[model samples]
Target: MFRLVGSSVQLDIQDPKPEFHDLFWVINRENNVVQYDNKRKNMMYYSDYGGRVEFNEETYSLTLKNLQKTDSGLYEVRASGDEVRVVAEYRLSVLDPEEAPVLTHQLSRDTCNITLTCRGHDLSINSSCYKETCEEKEVTSPGGVILSLSVSGSTIICNHSNPVSWKTDVLEMKELERLCADEGEGEDKVN
Candidate 1:
């Protein structure tokens, strides 16, 4: 699961058996986060997780608050008893919110050809529009950020997104037509 920094997430242990004894939430199989003692009917939050972690006694679930990038890792729930058993595990990734996409356009008077560029994060996409038709392109980066452009009627939309956040910019096709119309008026003067 992907989360934005400073956000909170709930880690649920599905189908928890009542027969299990003590439950431990460990990070990356090394760092002990929280321990729930079924016999004692209490929970212990370790290290910096104190006050920022909540344990549900009834559901045997965990809720972590104020997530940070360093908190991204594999989390496991283990039942400690005569025979240690792994109950559930989850992979969490914390990422920063994506910025709004930038849109730029170029038009030629001769052919009235238009090219619109949308850029966000490390990716960029270009869309070409002529008359009432537009062509779209999309791109993705290794970090999971996506940039895309699409057309709906007279509106062109550029979107930039990650798992946690999304930003978009829109342009009206009529505005482009008006600009091209004005450029056509100056064509004879330039020649």
Candidate 2:
């Protein structure tokens, strides 16, 4: 499961047999997250999960809040009776939201060269635009963030995205066209 930072996630027991299992324990790898004692109707949150964890008595589910990047790990649910048995397992990944991509353009003659840089991902896309159309490229960063540059009419669109979130930036090219047009007119008048 992929989640954004500061978000919340609920881990529920899959195919729960409420009658067979009364004691439920949620574990994040080797660390104990929370445990519910159905017989005594008591819930305990261990380690640093005191107020960040919530346990539902009826569904034997655990909800974690205010997630951080360090919380990405494998989680397991163990139900104990005569012997401890694993009921559900989950691999969680927490990522910070993507920032808007930076779109920069340089105009010369009839073509406008553009570069799109994704913040934090260290990925960039360089393309050329002619008149109202632009070249498009899609690049994937080393950390799995995706950077894309596309053209919509006279607007250049740059998008930065990951599994958890996405952001975009736009550059309008109408001014570039006007500048180039004026430069062309000035050359004609001088000739």
Candidate 2 clashing pairs, residues 3+ apart or interchain: none
What TM-score against the true fold does each predicted structure earn? 0.92, 0.85
Determine the C-alpha RMSD for candidate 1 after optimal superposition of all C-alphas: 1.7
1-191, model 2: which lDDT tens digit per residue?
99999999998887557444345554565787876776778777887765888888778788999998988888888887777778888998999999877877666653344333333357887777666667788989777899998777777778899999999888777765775677678778979
Show where candidate 1 strays beyond 4 Å.
189-191
- Checking candidate 1 for backbone clashes, the offending pairs are none
Per-model C-alpha lDDT, please?
0.87, 0.76
Tell me how far the alpha carbon of residue 160 in candidate 1 is from the true structure, in angstroms, after superposition.
0.3
Which 10 consecutive positions of candidate 1 have the poorest summed lDDT?
13-22
- Candidate 1 matches the true fold with a TM-score of 0.92
